[model samples]
Target: MTSLQHVSTISAPLPAPSRQPFALALSILLTAGLTGYLFNAQDSHASLVLLLGAALGITLYHASFGFTTAWRTFITTGRGKAIRAQMLMLAVAVCLFFPALSAGELFGQPVNGFVRPLSVSVLFGAFIFGIGMQIGNGCASGNLYHAGGGQLRAIPSMIGFAAGALWATRDYEWWTTQPSLAPVGLIDMMGVVPAIILNLLVFAAIAGLTRHLEKRRHGELERDDNGSDQPWSRRLLSGPWPFIWGAVALAVLNFATLALIGRPWAVALGYPLWGAKAAEAMNLGLDVDFWGYWLMPGRDTALMGGILEDSASLMNIGVILGALMAATLAGRFSLSWKMPVLQWLAAIIGGLMLGYGATIAFGCNIGAYFGGIASGSLHGWLWLVAAFAGSFVGTWLRPLFGFSRT
Candidate 1:
């Protein structure tokens, strides 16, 4: 193809010049601010570790998705380098959380207050979440990242997501009031260490099996014109390690947030809040009732409830800033909007599902799946299974609706 043709075909939307710089600076400022906030607010060292793990997870996620070269290489070669990074993240989380179980503390604080959901509830929520993410074309975190990257489709998806979350929040009281719903915790398990070991074993077995299958099928395929032969080491270092480090840093920040804030980190609550606010503005009068009764609880309301109920919103904003900063610095900001109509609809539906499911599950991919698994909660694993099953079903059905796999 000619140079002009190539450029035209690959062109994506670019963030405004002023917004680009603002996004970068804002990201840095938020990281610093949140970190300081967490340190001052939390008391647990384990919570600090969790915050660090979360940061690492976000960084790796960005590196895996935002970097076109790395992503392309992985796609061409079918390598697990990115997946390995995720696995390592889970490993670190498992290691850190298991010990906290035995000690009955997270970062040296009591863990009794953190609530867990029943397996059945988690599974049901996961199924809904899976379908939502499939339709939405991204999960909670995924939406923020894509939006920051200038995907216009994400805008509508997020709107739908907020609407769904608002609906769920309005109905949260009735849902939690159900007899089948009860707060659960991992302390009732055989302690954290055993749980960690078991999880590690399972992860190892799965990794080994996956590796074996890839080797058998591809026979160490070399990089071809299809861009498959990139060295693993090169791929690992191609993107900014600082970005990855930033994600790890976010994890540490989250731990501090939990200790200080008395709740795990999250990023979906904001959607619901926005939904509620919008409804209120429209004279629906949903905000006062929803915020007063279901969202806020206890006499120390301002100090405690605000932090837990609003953590997801804060995190969601941070994610957008973070991704924007990463993209701008790398000169990768694009405003491209070329998705088909079907994909757009899918994204909207997915966002709605994610909002509703996350509220019911009491978390999203980050809170329920990642945090739950890290805490050695069985519910986290169950969510993963259900979500994955849903993802597979979504993938299979996508062709029927003209959504192609990336």
Candidate 2:
């Protein structure tokens, strides 16, 4: 080939990733049906929340936005691009969230953030959750999307997650008794503007720190994939999106969630409910109501009512179905049954830790770290510090379970 032709050929867009038409069709059909059901059964708001979750799944899958992977990469290789993306995400989310929370509503709906106590339970739980993220190879949202994207490994992790969350419920009251401060929201303590400024400052500092560390280690910042020369429309439809795009999309969708549902986006809350429902089905001798957690007013109602009645459950379902749609559209939907015994053990144990830790911590990465921080809650910052510490240890342990640190 001539020089010009060679250059043109090299720059040309790569072939499209294969699309799983059947899977795509299935996801589309299910999404449509669910939207109708949620609208009729609950309200327009419920339907909208489900769609927002679908949007979140698509964003997550396309951008490969994952806390576990980002933290692990930073821990193992000092690559800070993904970590910086996380900061961008947080910054955007805080900006969107704080204004609404400060006003105490979004649109006509009264809204609330995920502000909770800073407690020993949170410290210990977030720490273990970080470790779980490394070993399980996925965090709360990660496992859901992975499962949705047809990763067989996530199945075992989810099963263990459910079981572990159930186990935590058995002793939920004990965790509540631990030493803790009352809920402290930056927005609540400081004015909204001040809280936003503080959060923005912290995000910038973290991002800058990562850049410095990455530069020191690699002698330059690592660049993200710039993407091929495909049209933006095609890339949007079947994407390996830029991380910055993912961050922005997530922030917007999360804001949508708040406006629609009067609360931020959260998924881990669904795990224990599914677990309890499953246990009930199997006639597991455990009396769910006997647990103090379930004995709470809303908890009892959720357990007794149909799963569709629960907003979190609906959103979680949407996430999975949405991810499936994204995966199939990207022609990346496939499964593997083969897992080494050691790796399998890691999945189960790690999942258990994730489930248990999230339950005690009152949320996972999405709920605790992302939602908490976006809400300007002190606990969110605590969760971040503790989880990162745990992730550091978990990264070191990955090789023992046959996972590469990178």
Candidate 3:
């Protein structure tokens, strides 16, 4: 869902040769074993989903397509290049998804886009998520790929995500009382062409606005594209890819997801389900009917099922493994086992916020922001505005965590 920026162009400007054969071997073995398990445990579709997740991870890693970093850079430096990428990604996804969704099927399977209710929860959740991104230093998808690339900090954030997600889901028994608008689909409400035109107009306006701001602030979109002289083949296999490619890959894969799974891309839904499974293992007397969301749309089954049975979970695994493979091939795998207390605390706190905010908001950067907007849900637009505002405030708070400029 990135949005990337001048802050850290994807892949760290052609990563220096930093290979680990052991890591490479381990990654290969892990990928093979997982693929085998999925094929045997469920079916080819499950294995395919896992492979797609890995592809997402690889594309995200090599391209360094990041939502949190991109938005943070914009908030602090007024660089809108990454934000532009985010817009482009959304536009591409909508262009592909809307038509298929309107058609109601792809290859004989029913197709649908994410269209959650616009609610007070979205307002609160998105704003908190914005602030959380600053503290966490990564969005939901960002953490998965980064963790795979050996960023130890993301591990704690992930743990916190599970905690926050479970907590909020468990607490939603009361939160559901908040007001919400009935769900609406632009295609159904105003027809597909009009919806596309309206969304494109918004996208163009934003892009234009950002270009103006970037010029007024930094005189132009900042770039390091010319700084690197890496060979094309090397860049393709073991290095930094341009952000545009990341956007393209995400759009294509999301479309493939629709064709394969009958839905657009999503990542965070797996968090709570994982937590529920954990609670059940601990004999916490977890009930599927404790909160209504779990019972809606066959979610209870996904909650009770194994990881391989959940599309989002399988995709998440693929993303992590894909990032690992990409990092290994690019020779950029490094894990630090040490961290300052404040930073660690920030990571944990931020992660909890990410989980809570996203859960309550109905999705994270991926689900709510990307999938929501692509699905033509108005709440996604609201999520963007609130999250951006929160990010603005978060930039100021970053200094407290020893972050020079988050």
Candidate 4:
């Protein structure tokens, strides 16, 4: 997500430009190579998931879809265009997810929602994650797409995310013991139709509130209606797509993920595993031997397996490659390695918070908030409130790290 200082206001459309042929070629090669490797080594499903991830990356990049930026802009500027877009995305997702989830299967494959317990762990973790994302300048999904889009700054943030996730593993069991309510799904409490209706009402209320605030503060709503003047074919391939398009694409892609993987799309779950893999390669301590998370049956196998074998990891790679391809196609794949000391420090600290918070909270914005709410999990609502509060504080703290509030 672009920082407040970097936020684009309404402007005349730019002409379409040529693609970065070398970068585009490289991205395509990497994506195709990984897809083929996953297909041959794992199965057709793995390859499909990877492609889905790439598509998500492309959508996110083209649309500039972002959580951190959306929240920050709302807090600092009262512009809720992106926030409204998020509400739209979630609304669409629930409309698609609720019925399929209630049925217990899709196309003969068992499927489940991301319903998780509501707990103090979630409150604290999500709160810190909010702060971290503000300083780190990217949420989990933001980190992947930004890194893939050739933002070199995200590299340190991602590195810190991995380390923080690994560090959280040392105390995962204790956090789980924090006071909590059992997992509660709105669909379980009410029927699917009722749950959907209730969720839609809440989404409408939020969107309406944003509009009211923007009207009061700015005297007019900021429109997300800007894009290139190119033909449809060119715009589809190289884009600054309208916000609604991004929202719909994300919602549909998430639905596709559920049908393929039996679970909603997620990103943070793969970070610790990646960290552990690096640690193992460097002769660091084996987390599987000590960390309770890695000791679990499913996680243990994932830890022991090939890097590309894990769906989450593979999907993460796809997101990066996809973003690369998107940026290259749009002729905007520049990478810069310049940064001040304090900003760099902020990135590291923020990333640590993002990883640690997501680990304890049971998910980042994508998994816990987006997936959870769409699945009718009460925890998602809790995550949204807590993370938003944390983001408020984070927005204020940005100035300390050389970031402007507005």
Candidate 5:
């Protein structure tokens, strides 16, 4: 890639507004009611965590912290700042998670990390998910926030994602049948302190490497980001937030989720559960409980509950609504009826593939990559490598679908 191609770009900036009072009022009132109801109906703990998820959505939108765009920029532009920021976030998360996980308990509750075996399913699933991210124009979390923010096309992508995830459930038995290596937890093997040290070392090395590559290619580290001279409060409410700030906040939020939920955060697990509920509602009579994939106690129970009762579902809703609120505040929340035929096609296909891939892989970016890595799973490292490779292929296919590359 040339120096010209390495520069970052935002094709469409969010529209400006002095205020979106209606959205501001609506967003707060609706969520407050839901949170109050959930506190009475469910646990106060889960309700609070759901609100945190909304905060995450707001942070994500304001910052425009995107894995898809970041990866695409790196692939096409040789920019490594985003990747470095990811490393920093991961490093902080590692510090926070290790001591908690290594103790094998938090707040008097026993907890464990996701440490799944290395399998063919993970490799292929993450790879396909990578392609889906490019085509769908977002990852699991990305799709949620963008959809909430009234990106009309995100709805189709989300539908496709759920469809694809359910479709992959049919092959759950077959996918796992591929010979696999046993799961390994770095903490379990090397102890908490060693795991933290090793992870930090790896993160530092990667950060250093990206810095070298980017500087060698582009002759500088920081990208041009001229900001508006708006008041602090106004700018805070309406934003194109700093990428590093978003990254740090996400790491902290994920840590909080772990503390509250007793496990690492997961974004895509609810997709299939939502599908099963929909199928049941439609009188399709899907025997999800009998399905071998959800034979476990946790999976089985999540299936039995209504969507609103599920914690992950609540969090997901919060994220979408939060993004909606943020976009509204930014005056960027508007529907678009017109989309290119190929773009629509890409969205559907990409979403479906993402859903399918995430199912097989054990999680999406949040579940497998972020939480998995923070929890010291070997599968997380492999997911990163495989998904990046898939992104390379997906980037090549983008122009064929009429997405312009910078």
Candidate 6:
């Protein structure tokens, strides 16, 4: 008897659900809630408004940089001096901060944020964060914005980062109790004018270094006939207007986020919050002080208590939505889940490292490095050094982990 052969078709497992929608919704709701809280909250800092402006500026910068052909070339070609621009901006920010602090009008109010110098913790934290970013495929700021654009890898990286952060937060007290590397608030000594001049000098030095490097590399490319030897001027002007404007706009957005939120832009804390909540939900009995120490909660008065709720959580939500809106409008949005399992694992691990490292550093690249530099903190510079060193190490290991060189 010829039995009817029953054949079952096996299909590859369906890709993980896109969390973009959830991310978007959560962002909107959180933003709305925070806005309401700010409007209704009795105690407020005037510096917040200026911080908001900075946040806006940051957003503009990112968007513009991403879309701009010129900026892209500067980033990818190594010939265009994007790094120089960044250094210039950092110097400018440092100069501006001291003047602003002295004049009490930099952000339209007296500057209150304390500026601190480098520390051992900052160096160590930066190394860890830098390595984490390389493995996760983006830095803290890069991850939030990119994840919004539908990079599945970013999701895992973000998760890992948060987990790491949570772990770090639990140990924050001990970390802070350690000895600091330099005197806190070095900018306070030099005041505004000298600081600005110093920064400009540094900028000039970096420009000279960049020019030297470019000239050295020019002949090699010419001999190879790679057609990659574009002039700096041409590279700077290659992208359309939107790209340039978009980056500037993002920079403004970053400023705005800070002003309104009363904190610099960040992303790792959200993950830690989630982790903490999960731990609590599972009855793990984690210490509340751990979260509280990280400014997870605000101060409390006899009549009322302040809470440091998750601001980044909302900001991240908005970031994803904003990016999604941009991508969807431009037809650049696509669903992708093509990463290999090992890479996925790496992303998660890297993210966790980022989370922990960022917490120990008291911020991620955005909050600590970018904002820190802009705020005239010496630790910012240290972070860059450590992180870049870590990035180099990460790059060396990438091939071994199946990552493409490109």
lDDT of each: 0.55, 0.84, 0.81, 0.87, 0.80, 0.53
Tens-place lDDT per residue, model 5, 83-105, is 88889889999999999899988
Q: Which digits, one per residue and each the tens of the lDDT, describe model 3 over residues 221-340? A: 766362257777787777577667777788889889889999878898888887777777888886745577687676878876787799989999999999888878877677754667
Best by lDDT: 4
TM-score of 2: 0.94
Point out where model 1 deviates above 4 Å: 1-61, 65-84, 101-115, 177-187, 221-260, 287-309
Write model 4 residue lDDT over 1-406, tens digit each, in one string: 5562132222355434454788888899999998898788778999998999999999988888888888998998899999999999999999999999999998888999999999999999999999999998888888888888888788888999998988888789899888999999999899999999999999999999999999999999987764645566766788778889889999999999899999999899899898888898899765445778888877888888877888888788889988899888878787866888998998999999999999889899999999999899999999999999999999999999998775
The estimated TM-scores of all candidates read 0.72, 0.94, 0.94, 0.96, 0.93, 0.72
Candidate 2 per-residue C-alpha lDDT over 346-375 given as tens digits, one digit per residue, 9 for 90 to 100:
999999999999999989999999899989
Model 2 deviation from native, Cα RMSD in Å: 5.3
Clashes of 5: 2
lDDT value for model 2: 0.84
Segments in model 4 whose C-alpha atoms lie over 4 Å from true places: 2-19
Q: Give the Cα-based TM-score of candidate 4 against the true structure.
A: 0.96
Clashing pairs in 4: none
Candidate 3: which stretches are off by over 4 Å? 1-18, 224-228, 285-289
Which of 3 and 5 is the better model by TM-score?
3
lDDT of 6 by residue, 214-326 (tens): 66777322121111243433222221122334434444454444445544455554666666655666787876443545453341121022223345554555565554443
